[model samples]
Target: MNAEQALIAYVLRLADNALILGQRMIEVVAAGPELEEELANANFALDFIGQARMLYTCAGELEGQGRSEDDFAFMRDEREFQNLLLLEQPNGHFGDALVRQFLFESFYVHLLDGLTRCSAPGLAEIAARAIKEVKYHLRHHSQWLIRLGDGTELSHARVQASLDDAWQYTGEMFVADAVDTVVHESFAGPDLEAVAVLWRRDVAAVVEQATLALPGDQAMASGGKDGRHSEHFGFLLAEMQTMQRSFPGATW
Candidate 1:
């Protein structure tokens, strides 16, 4: 792919991850254990949706097509989405969701940091704007991870199990594919190897502080970048695209 294509792909990958995870969080909107956390979850969901819009707009422009952000978002099949597998994993319980976001936001903060220096000016600008929002997102999730991990024994055990169950998916985030390679080599994007090292350190520190055990590194699942998504993605898309799919042109 050319530089622009590579850059758009990279941006959309970030956006897709955010969007899918945000949608998952939204599923628990009214179910948060506390009122303050409910508001925080809603705010974070909107932040990811906003980022998704920005990325989709950029991708549409780069594609030079009549396609709009809505088209790219609601119309795509699960197999066409490039989100990380971790993001698409089901939100099992409160603890499950919290640990998942904690794991992702920790890595995403650094990813956005690297993106701020992208060779493409537009992509860099997008990343610069996004990094601010993601910083807060990382903080929010980190705080929850600590609270739940260090809370009552029941809470700690549940969160620990959540972390363990979700751990395998974490590896996919660092596995650089062809598109990522092109972006890094040609466009000064994130160095996946370096990001992985830093991610491990940051994650380990947080887990240690939370009094949670770090999960062992093992075989990682892949295929999101190559358009293969988990079965859960289809259900997510079905819910997410219901209105657009059923009505075709309905709007507020």
Candidate 2:
């Protein structure tokens, strides 16, 4: 596509990742294992949602089609979403959620850091503001991952399994496609290959600290960047979009 279209797509991809993960975390809002963690979970959920809002607003402006953030978020079909497959995967348990967040946040933080210096001023500004929050997010998840993976026998096994299951989905994060190439070449956006290297180092360090084994190399599942997703994505969209679909234009 053209430069503007590529930019819009790039922003939507980022927005979709945040929105989906934010929705997933909200599922555990009051169900966190403890009171302190419950509040922390809610706050983190809001952080992702807030980031989604900023990206969607930027995308809407770039598209200049009169679409709002709500429209992009609530009005889109399941197949139209461009979030990572890993983000849409079910948050099975406490460990499952933490592992998922840790993996994605590891990559996201670097992506935002690179975007902060991109040629696109609007995207660079958003990235600059977002990197701060993402840094905290990465820290939070990384610490929890270490705790769980190095905890009791059961905790260790569970988190290790979560990591392995989640590993397959991680491949998509770095597999740059045409959209990514255009965005990088035109807007000076993140180099996915470079980001992948940093992501792996961070992940390996945490896994080692947690006393967990690094997941073995295997066939990587992908296609999320192209609007293709895992089966779980449909259910996520059903719940996420129900209100707006039922109410049409109704608002608070």
Candidate 3:
């Protein structure tokens, strides 16, 4: 793809990641262990959804399409989405959700920081705004990882297992592709190699502090960014788009 096409795809990838994870979080808003936690989870979900809106809007503009954010979000088929496989995983449990967020945010925080200085002025501005919210997100999830990891024996074991299961999906975050290459070369966008280094160090430190065993490198799962998604994605997209599909052009 050319540089402009790659730039639009890159932004859409970011939006897809945020929107998918945010929708997953919405699934368990009422399932939080504590009321305070539930409220926090809801707010965090909104933060992600809010980020997705901005990104989708930016991408729509960049594409010079008449499509709105709702069009990009609600009109897309399952194969059209380009989120990471990690974000589409079921919210199996509280611990599962927590590990997923912690893992993704760890990498996302670094990514947005790089984008804040990218050559694309519009994306740089979005990244600057996003990184601020993501900083707090990282800290919140990091603290939860420590709490659950160093807590009771059962809690520790469960969350650790969650972390291990999620690790394989994490590999996709740093798998730089042609889209990444184009954006980076043209816009000084994020270098996934550099992002990977920071990701490992930060994640390792958190694991150590949580008294959890760092998972071994294992076979990685990818392809979500290229429109190949996990089995759960179709179901997720259907549910999320139900209202829009059932009632076209409906709005709040």
Candidate 4:
């Protein structure tokens, strides 16, 4: 793919990740054990959805197509999406969901921090705005993990298991592909290798503070950024696209 195509793909990948994760998070809207957490979770979902909208719009502009954010979101088939496999995994339990967010946010904060420095048109601005909110998201999730980790023995074990279950998927976040290569070379975009280093250090520190052990390196699952996703992704796509597909042009 040319540089332009690579950039569009990269932006869409970002949008897809945010949109899918936001959908996953909203599933627990009324299910959070605490009312405060429920509200915060809902707000966090909105933050991600809002970021997805902005990034989609930017991608649409870059593509010079008539497509809008909704078109990119609700009109896409399962194979068209490029979200991370980690984001598509089921929310098994409260600790499962919490650990998932903590892990992703740890990497996302660093990713966005690097994106904020990208010279690509529209990317740096969006990344700059997003990093501000993501910093808070990272902080919130990190504190919660520490609390749950250092809590009761049961809490510690479950979240530790959650950490291990989610660790395999973590490798994909830094597995820079062709799009990553083009963006970095042409636009001074994120260096995933560098981000990986920062992510490892931050994650190790948080894991230590939580009195948790980090999972050892293992075979990493990938391909989501290439439009290949887990089995759960089809169901997610079906639910997210139902309204738009059912009512073509319906809008507020």
Local distance difference test, per candidate? 0.87, 0.92, 0.94, 0.92
Give the top-scoring candidate (lDDT). 3
Candidate 1 C-alpha lDDT tens digits along 154-195: 989999999999998888888898889999989889999999
Segments of candidate 3 deviating more than 4 angstroms: none
The residue-by-residue lDDT of candidate 4 on 195-220, one tens digit each, is 99999999999989999999997999
Candidate 2, which segments miss by more than 4 Å at Cα?
A: none
RMSD of 4: 0.7
User: Considering summed lDDT, which 10 consecutive residues are worst modelled in model 2?
Assistant: 120-129
Question: What is the RMSD of candidate 3?
Answer: 0.8
TM-score for each model: 0.96, 0.98, 0.98, 0.98
- What residue pairs are clashing in model 3? none
Worst 10 contiguous positions by lDDT, candidate 3? 120-129
- Candidate number with the higher lDDT (1 or 3): 3
How many clashing residue pairs are found in candidate 2? 0
Measured on C-alpha atoms, candidate 2 has an lDDT of: 0.92
Q: Which pairs of residues collide in model 4?
A: none
Model 1 segments more than 4 A misplaced = none
